[model samples]
Target chain A: MRGVVLHAAGDVRVEERDDPRIELPTDAIIWVAAACVCGSDLWPYRGINEVTDPTPMGHEYVGVVEEVGADVRTVAPGDFVVGSFMASDGTCEICQAGYQSRCAHVEPVGRSGTQAEHARIPWADGTLVVTPGMPDADLIPSLLAASDVLGTGWFAAVAAQAGPGKTVAVVGDGAVGLLGILAARELGAERIIAMSRHEPRQALAREFGATDVVVERGDEGVERIKELTGGYGAHGVIEAVGTQEAMQQAIRSTRPGGHVGFVGVSHDVSLTGQELFYATVSLLGGPAPVRHYLPDLIDRIWSRKINPGKVFDLTLPLSDAAEGYAAMDERRAIKTLLTV
Target chain B: MRGVVLHAAGDVRVEERDDPRIELPTDAIIWVAAACVCGSDLWPYRGINEVTDPTPMGHEYVGVVEEVGADVRTVAPGDFVVGSFMASDGTCEICQAGYQSRCAHVEPVGRSGTQAEHARIPWADGTLVVTPGMPDADLIPSLLAASDVLGTGWFAAVAAQAGPGKTVAVVGDGAVGLLGILAARELGAERIIAMSRHEPRQALAREFGATDVVVERGDEGVERIKELTGGYGAHGVIEAVGTQEAMQQAIRSTRPGGHVGFVGVSHDVSLTGQELFYATVSLLGGPAPVRHYLPDLIDRIWSRKINPGKVFDLTLPLSDAAEGYAAMDERRAIKTLLTV
Candidate 1:
C-alpha cells in the first residue's frame, strides 16, 4: 500500500508502505475511497510542529469497510463510512455527553494514515458512521468533508450557540470557518459576518450566507464587527485560526455574555485573564467531536441540503498528495481532496 | 459622616467625611445598617493592590434608604435593601441578559464607599433590591452577605452548571467558596468537594453541604480531586481563588466537557491557550452578575432558608473599621462586619 509521509518540514511524499491490518478486536480495515488534507496537518508541514521522523499523515477519510474484526457490530464489510479523526468507544460517559473527542479511550486515526490504499480504524462501531448508500462520485468530497471539517464547523456553531436571533461571526476564512458560516446560517443565525481581507475567500464567505464582510483585521476588525452589530459585537464568534491574533479577535468580537466557539488549534496563544474575565463571555472549543455530528451531516449532505463539499477547491490523485499539501500551504486551495 | 479609608498601604482609618447626598437624579443616600470587609479589600490593605490617594473602600452592604433621588422608583426612602458592588442600569442589554456587571452603564459601588455612615448609591432603581419588610436585626449580616459573597457564590455555581448528578468542587475556602458549596447543594449537585487546608474553613465547608474535603494544594490538589471523582475530575469546579495556580488547578480538576466557574478576581494570572484547548472545558466567570441573583438570595435569607451570616466571624463598630481590616488581613477573621 502507498501512503503519505512527512519526513521533515515542507517535505510531503507519497511512498509505498506496508498495508495495515486489524491490530485489535475492535478494529476494522477500510479501503480508502477519499482522504483530505486538513488545516492542522499544515502545522507539521510548515515546521511549526516538529517531525523528528517520517510521520504518518492524514486523518480525515470517507471509505468502504473492506473487513471487520470479530468484535465489530454496527459496521460490516462493503459499507461506505465517514469517520472522524479521533476514534472513541462512543458509549463512554464523555462520548455520551456528545464530546467523543475526549473519550476515555480515544485514539487518533493519523497514527494509521488515511491517505493510503487502505486504513485500519480502531473502535470501529464508535468511530465510523455509515452513509445511507454508496454516494455518487460527485458527492464523495462532501462525504469526505463530513469526516472532519464540515462536522467540526457544525460543532463550532453549536458550541457558539449560533441559532435564531444570533449574529454569528467567523474569524478565519479557512475551510472550517467558511463551513461554520454555512452551519450558522443553517442553524438560523439572524446575521453572519465574515472577517476576511482576501477577495476569493470573501466571495465564498458571502455565498455561504455572510450578511456582511469586513476587510479589517485585529482591533480594527473587532471594531468593524461591533459597528455592524449595534456596538454589542456578534452573539456567536467562531475562531478557526489558532493564532493569538485570531483568538483575541474571536474573543473581542463577541458581546458580553455571548459565546465563542474556537476550534482553531491554539499555537502560542495566551488569553489575558483580566480581559476575558471582564468580557463575561463563555469560551468553549477544541478539537471537535466530529463523530457525534457525522450522521446528521451525512444525512444533510446526502439530501443535498448543504454544499459543504465545495470547500474542496482542488482534488488530486493519491500519488500527487504532495501538490495537495503545497496547494493548501500556499493558500492556493481552500481545501484539497486526495482521491484513492 | 465617617467612612473607612485606606490612606496608604496598611492604613485603615475611619475618618470623618461629609455626609453623602444625591449627586445625580438617579442616586440615593442610604444609612448603612451592615457593611463587611471583603476578601478583595485585603488586596489593597496588604498592598497586593496599590493604595493610591486614600482609597475609600467597601462595596458590600445592606442598608435602609435614608433618601431617594427624584428618579428613584423601584427603591425609595425607608426601604431596607440589598445591593451588589456593581451598579447597573437594568435597562441595558447586558443587564437584561443577566450579566449586569458588564452592563453598558455599569458603575462600581466601591466608588461611593458602602462602609460609610451615609453612602450614595448611584442608579438606585437598578442597583438595589428592597427586602420584603424591615428585616429582623439578626438577618442583617446574612442580607449583607447576599449583597456580594452569597450572590457571587451562587453565580459561580450556576456558571459551573452545578445541578443534579453533578460533582461540584470548590477551589477557594473563603466565605464565597463556603457559600459556593451551599449553592451547589441548593442547585441539586449530587456531591460537593471543598479544597481547604484550614481546619476551620473545612468545618464551615462541611456545614455548608460539602461532602468531601481535600487539603492538598496545586497539582496534588487537582490529583486528589480527580481521584475522588473516579478519575474523570469534577463535573463542575468553582474557582474562587484568583491566583494563576488556583486557576490552573480549577481547569485541571474539571472533567472534559465540564464547566469551570471562576469568580476570583485574577490579579496577574494568564491562562495558556493550549492547556485550556486540550482540556476541552467551558470557562465562564468574572465579577459575577450578583445583582441578577440578589433578589432570589435575599428571599432565601429573609426566610432563614440559609445561614450565610455565620461567615462573618468577627464584628466591630463602624468607627473600628481599622480593626476589621487588620483582622481580615491577618486571617484572624474569616470575614468582618462593620456595624454603623
Candidate 2:
C-alpha cells in the first residue's frame, strides 16, 4: 500500500507501506475511498509542529469497510461508512455524556493513515457511522467532510449557541470556517460574519451563507465585527484558527455573556485570566466532540441538504498525495481530496 | 453624617461627612439602619487595591429611605430597602438578559458610602428591592448579607450551574465562598467541595451543606478535588477570591465542559489563552449580577430558611467603623457589622 508520510518538518512524501490489518478485537480495516488534506495538516507540513520520523498523515476519511474484527457489531464487511478523526469506545462515561472526543478509551486514527489505500479504524462500532445504503458519487466528498471538518464546524456553531436572533462571527476563512458559516445559518443565526482577505475563500464564504465579510486585519478585524453587530460584538463567535491572535480576536469579537465556540488546534495561544474574567464571556470549545454531530451531518449530506465537501478545491489520485499536501500548505487550495 | 473612609492603604478612619441628599432625579437618600464591612472591602484596606485620598469605603447596607427624588417611584421615603452594590436601571437590554451588573445606566454605590449614617442610592426605582415590611432587629444582619455577599455568592452558584447531579467546588473561605456552599446546596448540587484550611470556615461550610472539605494547598488542592470527582474534576467551580492562584485553581479544578463562576473582583490576575483553550472550561462571571438574585435571596433570608448572616463575626457601632476595617485587615474578623 502507498501512503503519505512526513519524514521531517516540511517534508511530505508518498511511500510504500505495509497494508493494515485488524490487530484488535474491536478494530476494523477499511479500504480508503476518499481522504483530504486539512488545515491542521499544515501544522507539521509548515514545520511549526516538529516531526521526528515518517509519521502517518491523515485522519479524515470516507471508506469502505473491507474487514472487521470479532468484536465489531454495528458495522460489517463491505459497509460504506464515515468515521471521526478520534476513535472512541462509544460506551465510556464521557462518550455517554456526548463528549466522544474525551472518551475514556480513545485513540487517534493515525497509525494507518487515511491518506492511504487501506486504513485501520479502532473502536469501529463507536467511531464509524454507516451511511444509508451506498452514497452517490456526488455525495462522496460531502460525506468525506462529515468525517471531520464539517462535523467540527457544526459542533463549534452549536457550542457557540448560534441560533435565531444571534449574530455569529467565523474567525478563520479556511474550510472549517467556511463550513462554520453554513452551520451557523443552518442553526438559525440571523447574521454570519466571515473574516477573510482572500477573494476566493471570501467568495466561498458568501456562497456558504455568510451575511457579511470583514477584510480588516488584527484588532481592526475585531472592530469590524463589532461594527457589524451594532457596536456590542456578536452574540456568538466561532474560532477556527488556533493562533493566539485569532483566539484573542474571537474573544474580543464576542459580547459580554456571549459564547465563543473555538475548534482551532491550539498551539502557543493562551488566555490571560484577568481579561477572560473581566470580559464576562463564556469560553466553551476544544477538540470538538465530532462524533456527537456526525450522524446528523452525514444525514444532511446524504439528503443533499448541505454540500460541505465543496470546500475541496483540488482533487488528486492517492498516488499524488504529496502534491495535495503541498497545494494546501502553500494556500493554493482550500483543501485537496485524494481519491483512493 | 458619619462615614468610614480609607485615608490611605492601611488607614481607615471614622469621620464626619456631608449628609447625602437627592443628587439626581433617580436618586433616593437613605438613613442606614445597618451596614457591614465586606471581605472585598479588605482588598483596598490591605493596600492590594489602591486607596487614594480617603475614599469612602462600603457598598453593602440595609436602611430606611429618608428622601426620594421626583422620579423615584418604586422606593419612597420611609420604605426599608436592600439594594445591590451597584445601582442599575434594570430595564436595559443587559438587565433584561439578567446581567444587571453590566446595565447601561449603572452607578456604583461607592460615593456616599454604605458605612455612613446616610447614603444616596442612584436609580432608586430600579436598584432597590423593598422587603415585605420593616423586619425585627434579629433579621437585620441576614437581610444586609442579602444586599451583597449572599446575593453575589448565589449568582456565582447560578453561573456555575450548580444544580441537580452536579459536583461543585468553592475556592474562597470568605463570607461569599461560605454562602456559595449554601447556595450550591440550595441549588441542589449533589456534592459540594469546600477548599478551605480554616477550622471555623470549614465548619461553617459543612453546616451550609458542603459534602467535602479539601485541606490540601496549591497543586495538591486541585489534586484533591480531582480525586474526589473520579479524576474528571468538579462539574462546577465557584471563584470567590479574585487572585491569579485562586482563578487558576478554580479553572484547574473544573473538568472539561465544566463551568467556573467567578464573583471575586479581579486585581492583577491574568489567564493564558492556551491553557483555557485546551481545558475547554466555560468561564461565566463578573461583578455578579447581584440584583438579579436579590428578590429570591431576600425571600430565602427573610423566611429563616437559611442563615447567611452568620458570616458576620464581629459587631461594632457606626462610630467604630474604623476598628471594624482594622480587625478585618488583620484577619481578626471574617466580616464586621456596624450598627447605627
Candidate 3:
C-alpha cells in the first residue's frame, strides 16, 4: 500500500507502506476512495508547525469498508461511508451531547493518516456515517468533503446561527469558507457575504449563493460587511481563517447579540477580552463536531442539494499528492482532490 | 443637590451639585431614593482606571421619578422606577433583539451621576421599568440592586444557559457574582459553584444557592472546577471579574459546548484566540443589557422572592458617599448603599 508522509517541511512523498488492519475490536478497515489536503496540513508543509520526524498525512476520507472487527456493528464490509477527522466511541457523554470531537475516548485519525490505500477507522460505528446505497462515482468527491470540510462548514454555519432573516458574513476565501457560504444559504440565510480578493474564489462564492462578495481583508472587510448590512453588521459571521485579523474581522462584522461561528484553526490569534466582551457577539467554534453533521451533509450531497466538492479546483492521482500540496500552497488551487 | 465626585484617583468628595432637570424631550429627572457603590467604581477609586478630571460616580439606582419630558410615555413623575446603568431607547433593533446596552441611542446614565440627590435619565421610557407602586423603605436596597448588579448577574446566568442538570460556576465574589449565584438558582440550575476565597462572600454565595464553593483562584480554580465536574468542567460559567486570570479561568471551567456569560467590565484583559477556540466554550457577554432584565428582576425583588440587596454589607447616608467609596475600595465592604 502507498501512503502520504511528511519526512520534513515541504517534503510530501507517496511511499510504500504497510496496509492498515483492524487492531481493535471497535475498528474497521476501509479502502480509501478519495482524500484531500487540508489547510491544517499546510501548517507543517509550510514549516510553521515543526515536523521532527516522518508523519502520516490526511484526516479526511470517504471509502468502501473492506473489513470490520468483531465489535463493529453500524458499518459492514462493502458499505460506502464518510468518517469524521476525529473518531469517538459514540456512546460517551460528550458524544451523546453532540460534541464527538471532545469525546472521552476520542482518537484523532489525522495522526493515523487517512490518505492511504487502506486505513483503519477506530470507533467505526460512531465516527463513520454510511452513505445510502452506493454513491455515484461523481458524488465521491462531495461525499469525501462531507467527511471534513463540508461538514465543518455546515457546523460553522449552524454554530453561527445562520437561518432565516440572518445576514451571514463569511471570513476566508479558502475551501472551508466557500463551503460555508453554500451551507449558510442552504440553512436559509437571507443574505450571504463572502470575503474574497481572489477573482476565481469570489466567482465560486457567488455561484455558491453569496448574495454579496467583499474583496477587502481585515478591518476594511468588516466595514464592507457592515455597509452591506446597513451599518449594523450581519446577524451571523462565519470565521474560516484562524489569523488574528480574520478573527477580529469576524467579531467586528457581527451585530451585537449576533453569533460568530469560527472554524478556522487558531494560530497566533490573541483576542482582546475587552473587545470580545464589548462586541457582545456570542462566539462558538472549534474543531467542529464534524461527525454530528456528516450524516446530514452526506444526505445533502447525495441528494445533489449542494455541490461542496466544487471547492476542488485541481484533481490528481494519489501518487502526485506533492503537486496537489504545492498547488494549494501557492494559492493556485482552492483545494485539490487526490483520487485513490 | 449633593453628589459623589472623584476629584482625582482615590480622592472622592461628597459635594453640592445643581439639581438635575430634564433637558431632552426623552429625558426624565429622578429624585434618587437609593444608590450604591459598584465593583466598577473601584476601578477608578483604586487608580486602576484613570481619572484625569473630576468624575461623578455611581450608575446603580432606584428612585422616585421627579419629572419627565413632554415626550416621555412609559415613565412619569411620582413613579418609583429602577433603570439600567445604560439608558437605551429600547425600540431600536438592538434593543428589540434584547441587547439594550448596545442600543443606537444608548446614553450611559452612569456618567450622569446616579449617586446624587437628583439625576437625569435619558430615554426614560426605555431605560426605566416602574415598580407596581412605591415599595416600603426596606425594599429600596434590593430594588437598587435590580437596577444594575442583579440585572447584570441575571443576564450572565441566562447567557451561561444555567438550568436543570447544569453545573453553573460563578467566578466573582463581588455583589454581582453573588447575585449571579442567586440568579442561577432561580434559573433552575441543579448545581451552582461559587469561586471565592473570601469567607463572607462564600457564606453569602451558599445562602444564595451555591452548592459548591472553591477558594482556589486562576488555574487552581479551574482544576477545582474540573475535578468537581468529573474532569469535564462546568456546563455553565459566569465570569464576573474582568481580568485576564478570571477570563481564562471562566473559559477553562466551561465544558465544550458550554456557555460562559461574562459581565465583568473587562479591564486590560486579553483572551488568547487559540485557547478560546480549543476550549470550545461559547462566550456571550458585555455590559449585560440590564434594561432587558429590570422588569423581571424588580418583580422578584419586590415580591421578596430574592434578597439581592444582601450584597450590600454597609449602609450610609448620601452625605457619607465618600466613605462608602473608601469602604469598598479598602475591601471593608462588599457593597455600600447610599441613602438620599
Candidate 4:
C-alpha cells in the first residue's frame, strides 16, 4: 500500500507501506477512497512542530469498509463511512456529553495515517458513521469533508452560540474557517464577517455566507469587526487560526457576554489572564467533537444542503502526495484532495 | 463626612472627606449604612496593587438613599437599597443581556468610596436595587453581602452553570468563594466540593452546603476533585482566586465539557493556550455582572433564605476603618463589617 510519510521539514513522500489489518475486535479495515492534506499537517511539515522520526501523515478520509472485526457492529464490509480524526468508544460519559474528542478511551486516528490505500479504524462501532447507502462519486468529496473539517466548523459555530440575530465574526480564512461561515449561516446568524486578505478565499467566504469581509489581521482586524458590529463587537466570534494574534483577535472581537469558539490547533499562544477577565467573553475551544456531528453532517451532505467540498481547490493522485503537501504548505491550494 | 483612606500599603486611616451629592442626572447620594473590607481591597493594602495616593477605599455598601437626581426613577430618598460596586445604566444592550457590570456607561462605585458617611452612586436607576422595605438590623449584614460578594458568587455559579445533578467545585475560601458554595447549593447542585485548608473557613463551607471539603491545594487539590468525581472531574468549577495556581487548579478540576467561572480580580496571571485547549473546558470570567444578580440576591437575603453575612467574622466602627483593613490584610478575618 502507498502512504504519505513526513521525513523532515519541507519533506513529504509517498512510499510503499505495510497494509493495515484488523488488530482488535473493535477494528475495521477500510480501503480509503479519498484523503486530504490538513492545515494542522503543516505544523510539523514546516518544522514548527519537531519531526523526530519519519511519521505517517493525514487524518481526513472517506472510505469503504473492506473488512471488520467481530465486535464492530455499526459498520460492515462494502459500506461507505466517515470517521472522526479522533476515535472514541462513543458510549463513555464524556462522549455522551458531546466531547468525544476527549473520550476516556480516545485515540488519534492519524496514528496510523489515513492518507494511504487502506487504513485500520479502531472503535469502529463508535467512531465510524455509515452513509444511508453508497454515496455517488460527486458526493464523495463532501462526505470526505464530513469526516473532519465540516464537522469541526459546525462544532465551532455551535460553541460560538452563533444563532438568530447574532453578528458572527470569523478570524481565519482556511477551509475550516470558510465552512464555519456556512455553519453560522445554517445556524441562522444575522450577519457573518470573514477576515481574509486573499481575494479568492474572501470570495469563497462570501459565497459560504459571509456578509462582510475584513482584509486585516491582529488588532486591526478586531477594530474592523467592532466597527461593523456597532462598536459592541460581534455577538459570536469563530477563531479558526490558532496563533497568539488570532486568539487575541477573536477574544477582543466579541461583545461582553458574547462567545468565542476557537477550533484552531494551538501553537505557542499565551493569554494574559487580566485581559481575558476584563474582556468578559465566554470561551469554548479545543479539538472539536467531530464524531458527535458526523451523522448529521453526512445527512446534510447527502441532501445537497451544503457543499463543503468546494474547499478542495486542488486534487492529486495518491502517488503524488508530496506535491499535495507542497501546494498547501505554500498557500497555492486551499486544500488538496488525494485520490487513494 | 468621614471615609477610609489608604495613605500607602499597610497605612490606612479614617479621615474627613467631602459629603457626596448628586453629580449627574443619573446620580444618587446615599448615606452608607454599612461597608466592608473585601479580599480585593487587600491587594492594594498589601502592595500587590499599588496605592500611589491617599485613595479613598471600599466599594461594597448597603445604604439609605439620601437624594436622587432628576433622572433617577427606580430609587428615591428614604429608600433602603443595596447597590452593585459597579454602576450601570440598565438600559444599555450589554445590561439588557444581563452583563450590567460591563454596561456602556458603567462606573465604579468605589471611585467615590462607599466606606464613608455618604457616597455618590452613578447610574442610580441601574446600579441600586431597592429592597422590598427597610428590614430588621439583623438582616443588614446579609443585604450588604448582596451588594457585592454575594452577587459576585452568584454570577460565578450561574456562569459555571451549577444546577440540578451537576457536581460543582469551588476554589478559594474567601467571602466570595464561601458565598459561591452557597450559590451552588441554591442552584441545586447535587454535590458541592469546597477547596480550602483553613479550619474556620472549612466549617463555614460545610455550613454553606459543601458536600465535600478538600484541604489540598494546587495539583493535589485537582487530584482530589478528580478522585471525588470518579476521575472525570467536576461538572462546574468556580474560581474565586485570581492567582495562576488557583486558576490552573479550577480549570484542571473541571471535566472536559465542564465550565469554569472565575470572578476574582486577576493579578499577574497568564494562561497557556495549548494547556487550555487540551483541557477542553468552557471559561467565563471577569469582575462579574453583579448588578444583574442584585435583585434576586437581595430578595433571597430579605426572605432569610441565605445567611451570606456570616462571612464577615470581624466588625468595627466606621472610625476604626484602619483596623478593619489590617484584619483582612493579615488574614485574621474572612471579612470585616464597618458600621457607619
Q: Give fnat for candidates 1, 2 and onward, in order.
A: 0.74, 0.50, 0.76, 0.82
Could you tell which candidate, 1 or 2, scores higher by DockQ?
A: 1
Candidates in order, interface RMSD in Å = 0.8, 1.9, 0.9, 0.6
lDDT of 1 at A208: 88
In model 1 chain B, the worst 10-residue window by lDDT is B48-57
TM-score of the A chain in model 4: 0.99
The CAPRI-style docking tier of model 4 reads: high
Tell me the spans in candidate 1 whose CA falls farther than 4 Å from its real position.
none
Best by lDDT: 4
Candidate maximizing DockQ: 4
* Chain A: TM-score in each model: 0.99, 0.98, 0.98, 0.99
What lDDT tens digits, residue by residue, belong to model 2 across residues A91-113? Answer: 97678878888776879896667
| Local accuracy of candidate 3 as per-residue lDDT tens digits, A161-203 | 9999999999999989999999999999999999888999999
lDDT per residue (tens digit) for residues B1-340 in model 1: 8899899888889998888888998998899998999999988888888877988889999888999888888987889988989999898778898988888888999997888887888888888999999999899989999989998999999999999999999999998999999999999999999999999999999998999999998999999998998888999999997989999999999999999999988889898789979999999989989999988888888789998998999999989989898887888889999999
Ranking by TM-score: 4, 1, 3, 2
Candidate 3: the clashing residue pairs are none
DockQ of each: 0.81, 0.58, 0.81, 0.88
Task: Report the candidate with higher TM-score, 3 versus 4.
Answer: 4
Q: What class would a CAPRI assessor give candidate 2's docking? A: medium
Per-residue lDDT tens digits for candidate 4, residues A110-223, read 999999999999899889999999888989888888888888899899989999999999999999999999999999999999999999999999999999999988888888
Model 2 chain A is weakest, by summed lDDT over 10 consecutive residues, at A270-279
